[model samples]
Target: MASSSTNLNAQSKFDVFLSFRGEDTRTGFTSHVVEALRRKQIQFFIDDEELQRGEEISPALLNAIETSDISIIIFSKNYASSTWCLDELVRILDCKKRNGQIVVPVFYKVDPSDVRKQMGSFGEAFVHHERNFPGEVRVQKWRDSLIQASNISGFHDSRSFRNDAELVEKIAEDISKKLEDLADPPNFDGYVGFNSQIERIKSLLCLELDDVRIVGIWGMGGIGKTAIAEAVFHQISSREYSNHFDGKCFMRNVREESRKMGALYVRDEAISRVLGESNLKIGTLTINSYIWKRLRRSKVLIVLDDVDDNFIQELESLVGQLNLYGPGSRIIITTRNRGVLGVNSIVYKVKGLEHDKACELFCRKALSRKNRSDDLLELSKKVACYADGNPLALEVLGSSLRQKSKEQWYNKLHDLTLISEPRIYKVLKISYDELSPKHRKIFLDIACFFKGEQVDNVTRIQDKPTSLRYELEFLADKSLITISYKRLQMHDLLQEMGQTIVREESEEPGKRSRLWDHEDVYDVLTKNKVRINLFDIIFLSIHP
Candidate 1:
C-alpha cells in the first residue's frame, strides 16, 4: 500500500479544500494558508474559475468539496454578495452533512451572528439579490447553508491572533494535527516475523480462482492473526492478478471496535468502505436487502479483522449469503474462535514464529537495531526462548527490556519463570475475559489441574456437571484449550497466566479460586478451611 493509503477516508482525495471569496483573501490570508499547507505537504484544492452572472457551481468544484477531508470557509463582508460563492458554500455544507467532511469557518472581519442571521452586510447582499431576481428558487437554501456553517465551532478572527500570519499558522497547524489523527492504519514498518505466515495465507487464498471464497485465519490472541490478514489484504489490493476486484476494504479490529462503537457503526463502516459510498445510513432502507442487491453487481475483497464468535451472525447479515456476492469476491475473517466460522469454512491455524526468527525479532526490538551486542546476544536468545515464539510476548518483553543492564535482563528472565509479565498477560487475558463464567471456570480448571488429563476421565468426575463436555468444547473453540489424542492441552504461557491470576485473587490458597500445588491443596483440605463468598464450595481436581 502507498504511504498515503493509511489516510484513506470515504472519499478523501484532498486533505484540505479552500472555499472562500477569492477577492477577499486569495492574495493574503488564503495564500498564506496554502503556502503553509504546501510546506507541510498537505494536499489541497482551490477553484480559480471566474464566475459569470447566474452561472452554476462547476461540477469540478463540487466534486473537490465532496472529496476533501476538510473545508475552510472564509466568511467575509462581501462573501454572500456572489452567487458563485454562495453556491460553493451550499455544496460545502451539503458535503459536511453527507460525507462527514470537516468544516472550518474563518470569521474574517464579519460577525458570526450577522452571518447566521444574514444581517448588516449580509442583509445588504440579500436585499440586492432579492431586487435583482425576485422569488429566486435557491435563495432560502443559501440562507440555510450559511446558518448551518456558522453554527459549527471554528476559528473566529478577532483579537485572538497577533496578526493574519499568526492566524494562518494556527489554522494550518491545527488542521495538520487533525489529519494526523484521522484513520492512520496499524504501523507495520518495524513489524517482523510474519512474512512466511502471510505467504502461506496468500497461497491458500488462490487469487487465480474465480470462486467467492471465505477463508478463516484462526489462532489464539496475539498470535499475529490480524497482522497476517492485513498483509494479505494489502497484497490483494496491490497485486497484479488479485487486483481485479471492483472494491477493496480492510475492516480492522472488528471485535474491539464493535465493542467500543456499536455494531451498527462497524456494519456501516464495512458498507461505506466496500461500497465506496460516503456516510451511508442504512436505517433509511432495508439495509440487508439493499446490500444483497448492491453486492451482487461488483466483486469486492474484504477483510473482517479480529472477529469474535459472537460477531459471526452479524457477519452473515453484513455479507448477505456468500453465494450472492459477485464472482471473485473473497472474504477473510481473523478469529480466535474457529467455531465462529463453522465446521465447513476453510481455516488456517496460525502458530508461533520459529526459534531463529523469534530470536531475530526479539533482538531487533530489544536493541532497537538490526545488529546485536556480543554481551547481549546470549541474553537476547534466552529472553526470546522464554517468549516461546509468540510474537506479541516477544514485542512486549523485548521493548520493555530495551537498553536495560545485563543483570536486569537476567532478572527479567528469572521473573518470567515465576509469572506472566503484566503487559503480555493483559493482552492474552482479553480472550479469557471474554469467555462466559462457566467456560472460564472450565478453562481455569484445565490450566490448574486437568491439563493433559484424558477427556473422558475429566468428564467422568463425580461432582462434575453433564455440561463439562460442552464447556470443554467451548474452550477448545476459543483456543484456550486443545483436544489431542483424547487428552486436554494448553499453551505454557496461558497456563501460567491462569495460575498467576488465581494467585493474585488471594494470598491464602483456601480463599483462591483454584489450588494447583500439592502442599496448598493438602493444607486447605486438611485444615477444614471455610471457603470465601466468591466460591461457595472450593473446587479441586479429584485425579488420582
Candidate 2:
C-alpha cells in the first residue's frame, strides 16, 4: 500500500475508500461507481472490508481506512440490521467528526422517512430486538443511533437505479473535490513526473503494436534521461498488474553485473532474495534454467539501465534465454544509442525540460530562502531562461544561486546569456567526471554522433566499439544514464555535457563537431535532408 504522504505530496491527487455491503450490491451499483471513478482518474480503495467468520478488522485495515481522505457509506434496506455494518457506520461517522473524514450517505432502495421516523421495517427490527432481548438497552440505543444518522442533512434520498450516470457523476464530482482538498497541499513535494522531453518517448512508446514491444531510452550524462525512464518504471511497477511477475528486477548496468556479478550471480541473488535464502549456490546453467522457468510462469518488468548500443547481440542473447512472457511484460533498455532498440520497435528521443517547468524546478532549488521578493522573481526567471530548461544547467545555476540576492541572480544570468555558447556540456561534465574511461568514451560518442544511432553505427564508428559497448553500458546504467526504446537520444543538457567532455579530451578544439548543425551544405544539396526531428518535424512535413 502506498503512503498517504506520497499521494498528498504529489500534485492535485486524492484517494477515497468506499464502504459498501458487498453481497447486496457489489456487482451492481458498486461496480458501476468504481468504474466511474476509474474513468475520471479518481484513485479509490473499494475492496471487501468485511471480516471473515472468526476474523476481526486488522490494525492495517483500520489504519488504512482512518488515513483515507473520504469514506462513502451505502445505506441499503438492511444496512442498519447488521451489527457489522452498524459498527462500520459508527466508526466512519466518528472519524468524520473528529479527524475530518468526509462521509457521504447514499440511501439505496430505502425510504428516508422509514429510516428517520423508524416507523416501518426499521421500527419492526428494533422492536423485535427489544422484545427478544427484553433488558438489553444497547440494542435500543443502536436503533436510536440509526434513526439519528438517517436524519443528517447530507443524506441522499433517492434510489440509485440503473441509468443514473448524470446524478452519480455529480455526486462523484463532489466527492472528488473534497478528496482533493484533503490530499493536495499548497506546495509541491520533490516527486514529479518525467520531464517533458522524456514524455515524448512515452507518447511514442504507446503507439507500437508488437507482441513483445521494447523501447530503449538513451541520452548523455546528467541530462535526467534515466530519471524519466525510472519514473515510468516506478509508475507501471506499482500497478496491480505488476504483481503478475514473480518479481520485477532492476539491473543497474549490464556490464558490471554480467562481468563481476555474472548471470549466475544475478539468478542466485534474485532467487535467494525472493525465496529468502541465507546462502545458496547453483551451477550457472541450472541457475539460468531456473530463471527462465520462473520467467515463463510470470510476467516480469525488467529494466536494463545504461547499456552499450553495440552489445545489441548480447542483449538479444539474454532475452532469448528467457521463455515467453505475458502481454504486458516489459523490458526497458537505457543506452546512449537509439539504433540498438531495432527499427521495428518504438523509439523515444528525450530532450531537456521546457522553459517554464525548468524555471519552476530551478526556483525551488535555488530560492531556498522561503520568501522571495518581486524583484527576485523576475531575476530568477531570467536565470532560468539562461539555463534553457536543461536540468543540469538549472541545478548548476540554482545550486550556485542559493541564498543569493536579486543582484547576484542578474549577475549570473548576464554572464551566462552574454555567451552564445551552450552550457549543457559544461553542466554534464560534472557528472561525467565520476565515470570510468570506458563509460566516458561511450558518453562522448553518444552525446556527439551516436545519439539515436543504431548499434551498427557504434561498431562502424570504431573497430572495437562493440566490446567497449558492454562496459560502457554497465557504467551508464549504474550512473543512471538514460536508456529506453531501441535508440539513444540524450537530453539536451546531457548532450552539452558530453560535448564538453569531448572538447576537454581532444588536444585540438577544432576537432569536435556538433552533429545537429549544418556544416556540409553540398551533402544537403545532393540529398533530400530527410527532415528528421521530433514529433513536430514530422507533423510540419505532413501539414506542409
Candidate 3:
C-alpha cells in the first residue's frame, strides 16, 4: 500500500546505486542487468528526472548516494563528458575510501587505459575544458577522479563480452554473492501501477542497453512515458553493479524548459555538486556530452524524462561517443510527442486502455465500485463511450460521479452525445484547424446534422455531400472521427467539443451562422408554410 519512494526513504539499507549513460544502455543491456537485480530482490534507485535548479547538485541527491550500500558504474564512451557523472564517480571513490563502499565496473566499450589516463576523445574533451578554464582546480580534480575510477577492480569488457545473456547471468550471480556478504539488506517491495507493463519495458531496456542500441517509447500526454522510464531505472539501479557508481541515480526532467536554467541546465549544476567540486566549469560541457563522458566505463542508467521532439537531434552526435558500458548503461526518454523516435531508440506507441480495462478503471473511480453491475454496467459503458478510452478523462469523470446516484447518471448520460465538451473539444479543434477549408466545412457539417442522424440520410439532405467523402476519409485517418458501415460515429466527447467551438466562432452577427439548435427556430420552422417564409424566419438552430 505504501509508495516505493516512501518505503525506500524509510529504509536504512538501500542496496545499489546505478550510474550510466541512458542513451547507450537504455534499450539494450542495462535493462537485462536491472531485471537480474530485480529478480534477486535488490533495492536501488535510478533517476531519469531532469535536474531543474542551477549548476549544483541538491542536498537530497547527495544523501541518496551516501545512503546506498554500493555504487555500480557502467563505463561507456560518453561517461567522461558529463561533469555530474564525474562527480558521482568521485563520490563513489570517496565512499570506497571513507566507508569501504563496494564499487563494480562493467567496461562497456571503452578500455581501462581510456578511463585511467583520459585518453582518446575523453582526453581531448578534458584537455579542451582544462584549456577553457586554464589552471582550474576542478579540472585537475576531474582528471584525478577519472584515474581513480579506472583503477578499480571488477572490470568487464563489452566488446569481448560474448553472450550478453550469459554475461548478465554471471553479473547477477556476482551481485547475489555481494548481497550475501552485506550485513544488512534494504527492504524493497517494487513499484505500484501496471507491473507487467513495467516488466515489458525493462526487458526492452535490457536488450537495448546490452546491444548498445537506442530505444524510445513514444505516446500521448500522461500515457505513462516517464513512469515507464522510472520503472526501468529502479529495476537496474538495485543491482550489485550500481554500487560501483557514486550516486543512486541522476534524473533529468526536460519538460520544464529547454532554455537556460531549465532541467537539463540544472543537471549540469547537479553534476558539479555531486562531484563535490566548488565552482566547476560545468557549462563549457554540453549536458548530454557530460552525461555520456561520465557514464563511459561505469555501469549506470540515466533517464531523460519528458524530452521534446528535438531531443533526438541533440543526442545524435553523442550516441557513437559513449563507451558502450556493456548492458548496464541505459537511457529512457518519456515524451508525449512521437517525433522523438530514432534508430538507436526502439519506439513503442503507448495507447490508452482498452474498453474493458478502461471501464474497470472508471468504475473504481466513478462509483467506488469495482464489481460490474448489470444495470451500472450499461451506464458505465455509455460513460466510457463518452470518454473514448482516454484514461485521464475517464478517471476525472469517474471521480466526479463517484458519489452520484443512477438518476444523476441518466441525466448526464442523456446530455452526452456523439459530441462532448471541455476536454475533447479543444483537442479536436486543434486537429480540425489543421484540415483544409473544404475538410473543415465537411467536419462542421457532420457536427451539426450527421452526428446522431443516420449518415446516409444526412448526406441525402445535403446537395453534393457525396463529393466530400474523400475529405471525410482523410479526417478518419487522422482519428478525428470514425465512419463504419456507412454509420458515422463521432468520437463522442470530441464531437461535442468541436460543436461548442463552432458555436462560439459563429457568435459574430456578420457570420450569420449557428451551430446549436434553439427551440425558437424549430417553432418558427413549424409555423412557416413556404420555403421563402422559412428563409425569412431565422431558425437559429436549423440555419434555413
Top lDDT model: 1
Sequence-dependent TM-score of model 2: 0.42
Ranking by lDDT: 1, 3, 2
Q: Which is the leading candidate under TM-score?
A: 1
Which runs in model 2 stand beyond 4 Å of their true positions?
A: 1-14, 47-51, 128-148, 151-155, 159-170, 180-364, 367-392, 400-420, 428-544
lDDT of 1 by residue, 1-544 (tens): 1112223244446788887887888887777877767655567876654434347765656667788888888888889998888888888888888888889898988899999999999999999888877898789898899899889988864457888888887887778667756645556632477888788888887778777788899987767887788878866765345357766788766775575556677877777666655455674223667676788887988899878765666776665466777888888888888777854457899988898888887777678564467868888887777667777667656665667777878777776655555356754565476567877777788877777667877888647657788777766645566686578877555777888888999988898877666577678868979543332233333331
lDDT of 3 at 255: 45
Q: Which ten residues in a row have the lowest lDDT in candidate 2?
A: 1-10
TM-scores, all models, native as reference: 0.49, 0.42, 0.40
Error of 1 at 135 (Å): 41
RMSD of each: 18.3, 18.6, 21.3
lDDT of 3: 0.59
Q: Point out the higher-scoring one by TM-score: 1 or 2.
A: 1
- Residues 1-544, candidate 3: write the lDDT tens digits: 0001213243333577777777678567777777666655566666554545346655666666778777888888877777777777777788888988888888777888888888986887787777677987878888897777777777657666677887776776676568657743321211223466667776676643344545577776534565566656655565443333232233444543343234434455334433323333445335455554554545445566666654444544334334544344555666666666565676766666677776777677666445456887789887776666665456545654566778877766665652546354443344465568877777776665465445666666557777656666666655555674356655434555656667576454223343235443454346652233332243232332
Off by over 4 Å in 1: 1-14, 18-186, 239-242, 283-288, 419-544
